[model samples]
Target: MTDASALRTAILTSVPADPFQTTAPEPRFVYVPRTHVRALDPDNMLVVGARGTGKSFWWQALLSDAARATLQIPSMSRGKLQVGAGWSENTEPDKDTLAGLRRAGADPRQIWRAVLLAQFDSGVDSMDSWKDRVDWVANHPEAVAKLIRSYDDAADADDTRHLLLFDALDRTADEWTERRALLKGLLQLVLDLRSTKAIRAKVFVRPDMIQDPEVLAFVDSSKVVGSRIELTWPRHELYGLLWQYMGNAFQGAATFRRRHSGWKKDETGLFRMPDTLRTNEQVQRDVFAEIAGKAMGTNERRGLPFTWIPTHLADASSIVTPRSFLAALRTAADETNHDSELALDWRSIHSGVRRASEIRVIELGEDFPWTKPAMAALEGLNVPCSRKDLVSRWTANSVMERLDGLPTGDRNKNATLGQQGLLNDLVEVGVLEVRSDGRYNIPDVYRVGFGLKRRGGVRPVT
Candidate 1:
């Protein structure tokens, strides 16, 4: 038999190296639709999404002329856009400043305005005493406006637009209640900023940020919720992403060559890429079929590669992430490569599925430390169970006993949510799903993460 392992290796390596850290669209950057572009508007002020769906990628792209151009957002040509004058959870100074202000009881709106002053007012203070400097700028909007106007005049343009982007709201405060207050105040500030035409703010947040009762207390957030963009990946889009990655993978296949040749000769693909980047149906089917063959394995019973992978990767809320999807492909290749196979075998794909589940669990543990600890209590217990069965596992494992100071991935820190309350909290975060039948079933994505197995689902937890 001819050696085809190298071909398989090349095919695997052709996809993106790291889907999460994808810096450019070369190997793969999914196109953000015009509707999504409108939703991403800095003027829209609030963006809601889960862990994936390009929240971080979109936020980072806006900072780069190269990245912005690739997205083909209509707003880019609208004006001279100046990025991110406001605040982000990524910056140390911004995080510390907000934390300090919250520690000192400063209003979130005031703190946000102060952050904006750093960009608008050149002479604005950039020191640790950010509160006093921000307060000073707050008392003097004319100077900032003058600074803004002068730039508009110098550019010979009608106006200079400033965008304030906020992301990673979870990092704002480790203490649950304090974090909620900080987010609430920041939301109010965003709503208030709508009055200012030239200056705008965009917030990228996890879907559950607004779930706290106190955060919504007395605040009319209808406008904010309406603007929410749930970062959901559709079935076709997921397949489209697979094809897009393969098409860019620099593979020697005629199919990949044909698609990549277009991108190589056309400089426009890198910037202001066409709307039909990867939506070609024939190309998607041909490329995917070339890699995995017709079915996931020998028989149709094993499930098709395009459908089976995404269906298994999705969480309880039916949300699938690019991260998990890519992870499975890479893992499948890693597990079964160098075997005497033309492509990933059915057994290997399922193995990849398990590996992806495990990696996702570790990721969750990092983000929500309480994720494993709380869920581990149900290691041997199967799910889709009654409320009593769920509580029995928690009590048996002494879950509440170990929750003190554990991070729940949201407010209400200190494991203050008793057993039942913890279950409800998990449901809200997509960790646990409450069914219409009132029975609680854990999603497969998280089942392995928590080491919880279903009756007929994943293999027995080792």
Candidate 2:
């Protein structure tokens, strides 16, 4: 029976203590339902979710296990698509070489040819020349019609489960247009695979990236084919995931013990353990109550349940990772360890969660200018407005249009763009929603943020 403190130190030293374990780490956690790694079958699913919702954790977990089975970088261009400018003799002759050539006024077609050659060489050893590779696909259209097709055939024939996980596509520094193009192109490629039935693509995208017409186009095809899965976690499920991960990191050292063992066994697992003589369930309920109290004063926020304590705790470490929960806990542990205490702090955890949310909001805002205005307009209207109605009334365009017909103070594009961009920022921040029929609506979660009034006012309440 090792003490909790001694166990914590041993576990800390035993584990690498990295929350964002982009590389690898030992797995000790149970497969909580929320974070359960799904079997990679022939299904194209686009998984979209907010920050700290177990997107990356499950992604990495699948990737690590399915390494031999998954075709990670299926791009024919291999690594060339990621590289940008620069050339130094002392520097690496990376994929950026092609980007450098393009920058030096090289023909785009020629650069593409070289990249195609590189890809063929690395991906298809059977191919000899770039022309031959291109001709092979052209001559045998069905044989090599699309990148995903070839991979699919190979995967299906072997009964292999290939999980194509695309994470951080939004984080790419490519220009807005380029980013949109790349995603649309990749999605189009994925769309090509449905005809073959070989691999499954799961993309973890923030809501903003999915809102673009071009980006949305890709998913449309998949959705029409009925091959998309939205990533959402109930509060309880989310809490369960966090608890499972943390419990694993702590292993069975008395500090973190399980209530139940095997299905046929009588051992209690972590959920059955007692904290300060209180059962695990009781302790969890108490902790959640405390956290919810801090998040929303005892008044009880709208969407969040009054007894809301999801088994998992949301934090940045979970969001930025392939990292294990223990690793994230360790990172937080390191911060708290500075105070010579081996305990996790609620304040620090709460702050980490807030910081994670803020970063996501900022990123979404920058990428999607249309997001804010859409949200603000929805907020101001206090009710769903038709797409045309919103654009005609709530937007700066609407504002200008109203003022312009007055023969004084006409709408200005620059001012309108500035104002509209700000409003769009709100939408991107997940505070608003643009409905299918062109209407704009707010999520129930953010309804409180908008203080609505039915009274008539000359100026719209933004």
Candidate 3:
């Protein structure tokens, strides 16, 4: 086979089938972005990001010693930290039981304390139900405090730190008010633990959750909010991640490693990104051109593949997530013709964008169920349109009425939003954009998925 075909095979096999499937990412798959090093610090209590970013991925990654070593964070590289999930997508029993405890009039703060106490003291774990544990914790604050102190004392002696990670807080309750209250209690618990030297709580939260005024309304709330780090994947970092995966693949590892002097294998035999690849755009573009050609097509007007791929895949806020970027390239590799000179064909890259959009829309529905139906109301409607025109479409389709019927936690808020409020909600999530001329536009990543039309947009695959 030719070099292009061999490279295409390498990419298709190396890229993961599901980039968002972070329940147990292998150590080889962990690519650390330079900007995310601060986010991995145990001192940062809150880490926020939009869906498809690496919030859950990092949550799971931190739990693995191999993955933690790949991160190379000074505090975590030693592997001396004790990490446990206080709450996460996988901790369903804890969520359901905590919801029950809340209904039983148990204080959310006490409930969370019980969660921590159970981790350190087996007796707390012996309790059969959440209520029983919460009751025990509430009735015995001194005992709970003593247990935490003893644990911290041990960690201090060992020169180690204990971390409790919280993710998927939105799944804690069905009602927004209840979820907000529960989150507030968790944040307060994080603050309460701040005084302890060896015990810390890190919360991986959605941006919208922490941004709500009601959620952070507490004494010293800024202490948590002020130190929060956003999990973002800049353009160069996205390309860096791509190279990491490609460079580590068994079939093309030698070829890819030789192409760039900066790429190196670590002690674990996984590829580590160089500073130049992470920060230098021209270097990344040069490396990308080797596989996909100098430009997207024969001329510059068609756009450079290095820039076009990310530009089209970006959300309204101009954020291109690692998940979407990887997914698009993987699909492009799969669709590229075997006889083609490029590893990823320009036409296949466009196909990759469509696949990425479909995946993004599905993820949006999973995170915010109301988005699909709400966006569906504007199907076939051309973007860069006036707010009045957009509202007319929603009004004609009874979009508000349809949204009210959904079982989302934000149903009440969405129903009360009316047409104007709904538009703002979409804009806030990076699904829709408002132009400087007061027109509404949907980014290609979402526009194609929602079946919306644009005068010169990438068309959706029929």
Candidate 4:
């Protein structure tokens, strides 16, 4: 086929099939954003991000030497750190055991300490049940502290460190109260461990969880929150990530890399984006223009494709997650005509945004079940409307009642705040926006997926 056809085929294959399904991302796919270096530091215990961000990806990445090496963090480069999952999306401790321990009056702090200790000490791990382990930890506080200190000392002597990672803490408990208590306990444990020289804990938490007052109620909690780093993918970094994938693709690596002279491979043989490409928008735009063309259309009025792709995909908060960004391009590649001169057609890019929106809605539902019904209540309602109209739509559809009637665990705690509260909740999560004029507006990313309309915005795909 022609060069453009071959390039489009390469892009379709290069981009991940599902960026959010990153339980075990391949090593070559680990493209670290420059801004995220702080989050990789062992010192930063709390790393926060919204859904579809790289929390789970980084959690899995850090465990693999190949992935960690790509991060180039001094602490992790030596391979001297022993890393273990204290809790993860897939590797959580038994829920029934935790429930039994909580019911028996075991402090959440003690429960988590037992969990951490079990990762190192065979004696702690040998306990047949969580009850026995937690009970042992509670009764032997001094002994537990002493054992942890011994591990710390050993790590220090070896010039290494031990890291315990926690992710998906939302699944730790069904009830909001129980989940908060468990999280508070884990945060408390994180604080206590910070004093150790060679042991550290990294928690990849959702923004809502970390910001909750009840969860951060412990002493010196601000220290953790104050030092927390957000996992974000800025515009340049998003484009940089795309190039990383294209530059590393098995088929079009040479052709794609030739478009940007700054791209180079690291010691691990993976392509590394230059510092300029990572920070310079013009440089990024120039490189991207080679594949997608200069403008989204025959003229510039339709907007530059470099900016248009992300603008349409951004949430109300103006945050464009890497998952959505990549998803859009992948769909764009798939929809582009094979006979087209450009690798990606501008019209197909719009289709990409639609697909990305659908994907975002699905992800939101997985994290917050209430979102689907709440948005369903507003379907077909034109946005940039007054708050009264928004509330009326919800009331008419009995949205609040529907959300409250959801199963005990599925109910969003925010739903208890009534209609206005639900609006605030949506605004907080970047699904809805309250404009300066007090009108409610939904960002295009969510607007299309939820079947809402805007007077002059991109139409939702049928």
Across residues 207-300, which tens digit of lDDT does each residue of candidate 3 receive? Answer: 8888789988899999989989999888888988887777777576666666678766679878776788768899888888888987766787
- Once fitted onto the true fold, the runs of candidate 4 whose alpha carbons sit more than 4 angstroms away are 407-417
Weakest 10 consecutive residues of candidate 1 by summed lDDT: 265-274
TM-score per candidate, chains pooled: 0.83, 0.53, 0.95, 0.95
Alpha-carbon shift of residue 216 in model 2 (angstroms): 4.1
lDDT of 2 by residue, 1-462 (tens): 333344344345544444434443234443334222332222535666564445555555554543212222243112111111111112222334423433445432232223332333234336664444434444454444455455546656775544445566554323455445545654564554345654445566665566666665644564522445545544444344444444445443234433223212112232322223222445555443332233322344522321221212222112232222333344434444434232444433333333333333343335443333433444445445554555554555454344344322112213346445434544545454566775555432233233332232111212
Task: Report the lDDT tens digits of candidate 4 across residue range 1-462.
Answer: 666776777677678887667556667767788788889888789999887788888898988777777777775665388788888656646666677788899999999998899988649999988888989999998999899999899889998888899988887876767888999999999999989998899999888887779999999998878989999888988987887777777676777666667777678888876788778999888877767887877788889899898998888889888889989999988999989998888888888899999989888887778888888888888888888888888889888888888886676657667887888888888888878888888888999998888886778855
User: For model 1, how does the per-residue alpha-carbon lDDT over 1-462 read when each residue is reduced to its tens digit?
Assistant: 222454456457665546557353441344564336676666678887777666776777777666566555566667777786244555634666667767776766666656665665466655557767666656777875575456435534556677777777777776667777777877876776666667777888877667666776646666666666666677667665654555445553334444333444235542122234456645555556656666765687767776777777888778888778777777777777576555565566777677667767776665567766687878866778888998887788777777754545432233565876787767766778888999988877777656676865655326
Better of 1 and 2 by lDDT: 1
Name the Cα RMSD for model 4.
Answer: 1.9
Of 2 and 4, the candidate ranking higher by TM-score: 4
Q: Which scores higher on TM-score, 2 or 3?
A: 3
Q: Per-prediction RMSD in angstroms? A: 4.0, 11.2, 1.8, 1.9
